[model samples]
Target: MFKMADNYSSSKENKEEIDKNLKGNEKKKFEINKYLPYILIILVLVVVIVLFANLSSELNGISNKLNSLSSAKPTTSVTPNSTTENSTILSDPSYNITGSLIVPPKSLPNDPVITANASFGSRLTNINQPLNKSELALFNNANDSYFEEAGQMILNGTFGGYVFGSTVGSNAEVKILDNPFVVNGKPSVIYFGSTTCIFCGENRWAMALALGKFGNFSELYKGYSSFGDHDIPTIYWAPAHYNQSAEDLGNFYSSKYINFISIEDDLPITGGFQLNPMSTIGARINATNNSVYINAFKFILQLNNFQGTPYTIWGKYNVLGADDADFGFKSEPSGNPSIEYKTHNMVFDNISHPNSEFGYLEYAGADLYIAMTCASINNTAPICSLPVIPKLESYEGYN
Candidate 1:
């Protein structure tokens, strides 16, 4: 009986030991389940850090490009001032006597009407129009700033590419022959028009701007068209500098590239600004090569029959007006008489308005200048070789 009781006690001790081991295993499983969320969170944090690092690099690249662009833009605006330094006046006697001054007998300060002496009167001419310093300052302050801007835009070829065709102005009807009329061994740009001509008044702005690119103009003076016409404020040929001395022609022409000859055929003769006969003004239009600035005018008439005023002959192309539409068409404003006249007169007055906002026509003028300069046979000036040029596959010459 005692032996049986001892065996029972040992079996009870073995059962208790098995229960303790099972509880310890349950505790180990609970600890592993509790740590699972923390391990997942650490992995997520590592992924977020890598993504943010990549985003930062991309943002930095964009910032660098923006900085480069900011550096390239122009920071200041240019304002044109009419100082003696802006225009170079030659002191040498050789450059002084470009030509004899052509003045109207009535316009000149004289007691009686004077006719040109036979020796002095001809197609080759320049006008001696005296300028009032204060009056000129008013005009210069109104226009010179815009003129400078227009010239730069033409040189840059950024005048909005108004036309892809090589022709300049609306009335490019005539084609110059390839014979290439030369004066003083260089190309000549001949202009035939009148100070009373409103179209010529408007065109002079662009002409001066364009030519100013290649050569300097010293004696250019400000004036206006006839009140009987549109009366637009413009530069008149009266005070323009030209080379008439055959002896000094070669030297002057060599540096200027093209010799510019202009005729202010009619002046404001009466208080009403009536047209009167000026010396050779008629002969100039019908003139042939007479050793005067080459036969550029004759060449123009030869290629295309005489059309009208403001005839510009260059290279092998001739431009009838300043733009394709011919802003200044008639001696007087045309179309819708009531509305057009008022509008036209307003534009004319606005040209000399003290406000800088006026003179949009300068843009058209710049475009014309750019086209003419590109077509010039003697376009060896630095401006002609610019990338902005050569935009025309075929310009005023040849085809």
Candidate 2:
């Protein structure tokens, strides 16, 4: 009986120790479960940070690519959808033929009529008008894709969308004849201006940019009007030959469909108020021959009593000054002042005047109107068939 009781006491003590060890294991398991949520949260945070870092790198790469595209000059070549293959009309034509006769207005019911004057305007001053090689390179390079697109926009008369300033004198009408001036069986243009004229200097920017569309220019010299004037940079046509071929053909001869009679008459006065006389070939053309320039000037004077300088005669239409339909950043009575030229030049005071404030794109539409109006007179040139011409023709200002 004593041996049985000792065995029972040992068994009871062993069972109690076993129950205590089981409770300690349960407490340890509960503590581990309490810390598990924190560990899981930290792991999720690390994964999100890694993903954001990858996305940020991709975005930085995309931003760099965009910046390069915006700053670099465009190198893509553009070709018109139209073709010149097997064309009856040559892409390049020599506009050399018999000159038109300019007749003086009849006085007192048909007085003795004079055909032409032989006196040429005298060159006012001996100002050097040559542009350096570096300057020319800068100008050519600047005429990149954006400049070309501006030209195209003007031709299409779609520049109104980009208008910026007051739209005054966009295209003021004087008078147009059903039959305009013709040369070599094509329409012609006559521009009479003076180098000393401030308005002419400002007008030349848009005029040069507009004319560049129809043909190329060669030996174009750069100069400013009289320093007393606004002193803006102008493409002095005294030496420029427009509508010429890229191969540097002879001056005063156009390879395009139309002809230009550009006359620059007077130079800025050096120390005096009186402008010096500048000799011009156009004056010679007017003196001894039947010239449209002489007739146009005389007719304009008769119509408006010496309206102003920088007069343009496109066929029968008489455009007195620079015209822009669109508004600019600054409103101008004559033109939109926000438009600028691509070519750069320096003023007399050593200040660099690179761009024009006039609306070039808007003025380009005016020039296109002149070209298309002339085309309507003699629709022989292939350029007349361009789709943009019709859209420009529909505008009200052209009539």
Candidate 3:
């Protein structure tokens, strides 16, 4: 009986201990459930804060990039085989000359208008005159060094700070055509400009430099743009009488590889604009007239792209306007030829060195023309093999 009571007491004690442990576990689980919503809420708030911070940082980074691009200068660099969007409109009124006589014809005339005088009545006062011998000597002697440096720059793919194929503000770039304008089984480079045009005055420097690479200028004459048109000092490829006559249709460039034909107006700016004369070659292009190099004039007039003075056709490529703007010397006071005269002399003196301001800018502009010429001629020139020439050609959409 004693043994049976002892066993009962022990069993009763074990059951009480088991019940206490179960109640403790139930109370702990209830406490955890009560705090579970608060824990989830805290975790969601933390995740939201982290996501907002990351989004804010990304937005700030994007904003900074936008600001940087908006404040940057106009770029004069281009990668090869890339097409840049041109923001400028071709028909912008700012590009139009107020009284330009070189207008697009309704139809190309079969023959040139034959005038008895060819001097455009009494408007033409002076005729072709040679430049001073002393002045000509300076340019002739400096040709060798200038050519060497210009070629070097083109080969290097950069001139001054500008890339070989890039263009500056509002300046027209070279456009490729389907066929080249050829003369006597040779490619022809034609230029039509006026002595009174300020852009023409500035562009001649670069044109002369680029042409020098392909040919030789046996004779160049001293000329001034016009008194009303800033009277910029310029060089004429042919003997020309400034502000006087346009009857002299002679050129001095001799190139066996390519023919250079220049048709320029001798008349300068009168009454703040050039005089209107229908008889001069600048005023009208006669298609069938072989005497005045009418083929080039007719080609330009037929194209809807022809705008104004300083027009050039480089092989199959056409540059409708000045390749570049004024090279810092164009700001001289009107009627003051001496300032521009000195500036031209300085450029001539430093033509061989790219360190000078005028020299660098002129050479950069020349490289652009040179690249266009190379593209048109199928890279026949020795300098065309340079890396920059191909890059420039590719950039301008050449084959």
Candidate 4:
């Protein structure tokens, strides 16, 4: 009886142990199965989120670019404040030039009219007709301050037009077009010059006088240079000396020299090129080498970009180097302190400027790495003015 009881107990114990082992294995299997679905779902969601994020970022980038391109202006010659907006009147696709149709000054007085007698006249030959009498009178005679403000604005950008002429020369060869006085209608132009350049700055009136014997004349006058290395307090290149800023170069230039025309802005410039060439004026107007100046802004566009008041671009030809007595300089110093520095060269003589280089070359090829829009140099108001350039029939030049 005892042995049978013991066997029964042992059998019961074995059965309980087996049951526990089976239970533990079943629990582990259940845990793995439960986690499988969640793991897979989470991986898929992460992939989807990454892809969506990339797509959304790309779309936003494209949208921003589209917005920027939509609004911008170019530098072109548009009719200043003309009602071209209200009316669908495009500019004269075809044009002609009469006494009134004449464009603003482009030539030195002697070579004023781009006629057969002038060297640059051929450039105009391609034009079908003479300039249209698109004359617009400027404001009442303004003051020196007003002219400075206005002229600076012009140098920075464009203003209105003038009934004048200018020489057609490559600014790349020389900085200035020519001493308007040097070849005034190819006349007595004994000498002419300016102060800063020791070459051309103060000679405008003198050259005009020499050429005045012929029909030569000039809208030219002296104020200062457009650029410099440093701005001493009383120096022309310094802001303290002249009220010039990046936004007023063009206005300042026009106020002092060109016909006192006010440049207009605040109009829609749709389809205007960001940096087109037409917007750049010619040698006589200043927009000529602007593109190049724009290009050279990195180096020469500093204080030296344009010289201003009392400081002008001078000219002298009878002698060279005001300090040298022989060529016109001094014995102790480089030259005597006189108005005879660098000799002026004629327009035709420019080809071989190996010895004497002009300011125009640097002006033309300078760096103007400005971005597309809002790239204007002058855009100020309450503009200043100077004496109206004594607009004669044309700019002084040699025949």
| lDDT tens digits, residue span 222-314, model 4 | 122112311000001101111211111211122211211111111111111111122331222244333222221211111121221211111
Where model 4 places Cα greater than 4 Å from the true spot, the runs are: 1-74, 84-171, 175-202, 209-327, 330-332, 338-399
Q: TM-score for every candidate vs. truth?
A: 0.47, 0.46, 0.56, 0.19
lDDT of 2 by residue, 1-399 (tens): 888898998888888988888888888998889989998999899989988988766764565445334423222211222244232322111122345433222121211212232221211222224445554333222333434344466555555544221112422333343344555665656677666555666565555544444444443555444445433345565442211111111123243655665655543322211222223333454565453455444433333323456666665555655444322334544532322221223221111222332344434534454444434455444444555454444443343
Q: How many backbone clashes does candidate 2 have?
A: 21
Candidate 3: where is the Cα deviation over 4 Å? 1-172, 245-248, 269-288, 329-344
For TM-score, candidate 1 versus 4, the one ahead is 1
| Residue pairs in candidate 3 whose N, alpha carbon or C atoms collide under 3 angstroms | none
Q: Candidate 1, residue 40: CA error in Å?
A: 99
Instruction: For each candidate in the order shown, give its overall lDDT on alpha carbons.
Output: 0.44, 0.44, 0.57, 0.23
Worst ten in a row by lDDT for model 2: 241-250
Clashes of each: 3, 21, 0, 126
Q: Which of candidates 1 and 3 is the stronger one according to TM-score?
A: 3
Model 3 lowest lDDT segment of ten: 92-101
Candidate 3 global CA lDDT score: 0.57
lDDT of 1: 0.44
Better of 2 and 4 by lDDT: 2
* Candidate whose lDDT is highest: 3
